[model samples]
Target: MVLKYCLLLFTTLQFIQARKVVDLTHTYDKDVPKYPLGWLGLENFTYFKMDTLAAQFIDEMWIAFKKIEYYEHQGTHIDAPIHFGSGRQTLEEIPPERLIGPGVVIDIRNKVTNNSDYAVTVQDILDHEDEYERIPPNAIVSLNSGWAQKYPNANLIFGTENTSDPTTFHFPGWSVEACEMLLQERQVSVLGVDTPSTDPAQPPIYPCHIYLQTNNVPLLEYIANLDSIPPRGTTIVLGAPKVRGGTGGPTRIFALIDDDQEQEITSNSASRNFMSAIFAFMYLNVFRFC
Candidate 1:
């Protein structure tokens, strides 16, 4: 009976674990900067509206979500193919299959601090091939340039400090070369970062965005707390966020890690399917028991 209880508990825990979610968004505030070339402005944000005891009864007032309407480009956003081209997926077409993948992190803070225009290169991806090998295709390749820590100083963080150079944008970006390395070579479906844009903060060289999205790739910008995810062996989840015909909706994201004593997570779909079924059964049983 004790052995059976242990199995039941173990199965229950493993099953419910598949759905752990993480928030990969950065809050929009006054400090976020607009590129000199970009024309965007926030029109409505939250201003204290009237409170009333109406909806539920029992002295029920609400501090509601009266949002300031602005372009999706203002905050942490996923760019649709239509953002750059006409007649493209309006954020709704992003395939779930492509949206989630093995999360890859390349910490380029040191190099980026020295040279703000640093482009993520082929060699950089090569160095982390071992990590990438573990993640499935269509995974999110996140570039960590330590840029988010500079959020307080939006100007300096964007690399607009005393450089007097146009490429003074402080962090690294996916080079068109690196984009190919990620997409064509690695076959990644999405590219992500913690900075304002996926491309380096420069003009006449938006190649990274063009290259990635031209192939229907997506971008996740303004991510934080990636330090929590393991370097490998974790399944990242983008829970189904319901936004109607929305080109892109803000996502809640996180990592699902599996520690197997015998086998490692790989490209074997059959194995993954089996594991997923086991977890699903466990979760259903737990819910039933509860």
Candidate 2:
């Protein structure tokens, strides 16, 4: 009996390890797009800088290191509630459990193609639920505007050659009403977007950021690889840094997808058969133990 239980546990662990992990974070570097400095009323600002700290040959191996400096929100990052809401949770204060949840990708690429300034509406959410299922509590809802393809190019990504001018910027974002429904009705934990801001570029007030952050919901911006994951069923894990008093910081996001779901997406029959065999073996082991 003891051996049977151990084998079952081992198999279960293997099954879990088989799940595909899609990295949803973009590579951070000096070239990544930065929020417009002009919008902050600053003429010049170094958003990201790097310097070589050490580069030498150790006793037997090469030793190299560098120092990096950048604003917390420069790259793919988390916007802690404190970013927009005074006295709210900071990066360190946010609960770890809140950083992980079921991922829901609401695709608005079609609408975005027609209008770069499109904002996700409540009806879009309703239509998503009609096709899929209701947005679950504590879910991480992300908007896929297909904006990531233009990343690293400030002009294209921001939809304006004058990247520093907020007035000329154009990008899709979440509408206040849609965010309100997710917070009030679905109780979602995180709101993510491929764009730089949670609110449309034309809206100087940033209603979505103010409203959602005040309600203690964090935001994930500049998320990459949304097109790589399924619309639903995957788990999103946000590896946010624990910076004391930080309003936001660069984050490493990952999508944990089940093997079956991955197989369905790829349509790999061999992988499907392998998963089925694993399940059959586990069932047989249970029967043998009983």
Best by lDDT: 2
Give the residue spans of candidate 1 off by over 4 A.
1-10, 16-22, 28-68, 130-135, 161-168, 239-249, 259-290
In candidate 1, list every pair of residues with a backbone clash. 22-253, 44-68, 45-68, 90-247, 91-247, 101-139, 159-170
lDDT of 2 at 253: 98
Q: Number of clashing residue pairs in every model?
A: 7, 0
Expressed as tens digits, the lDDT of each residue in 187-207 for candidate 2 is 999999998889988755699
Q: Candidate 2 local accuracy as lDDT?
A: 0.89
Per-residue CA lDDT of model 1 for 118-204, tens digit only, reads 788887777777555533576777888877776646566666764234455555677888888677766777788877778887663
Per-model TM-score versus the true fold: 0.70, 0.90
Model 1 Cα displacement at 238 (Å)? 3.0
TM-score of 1: 0.70
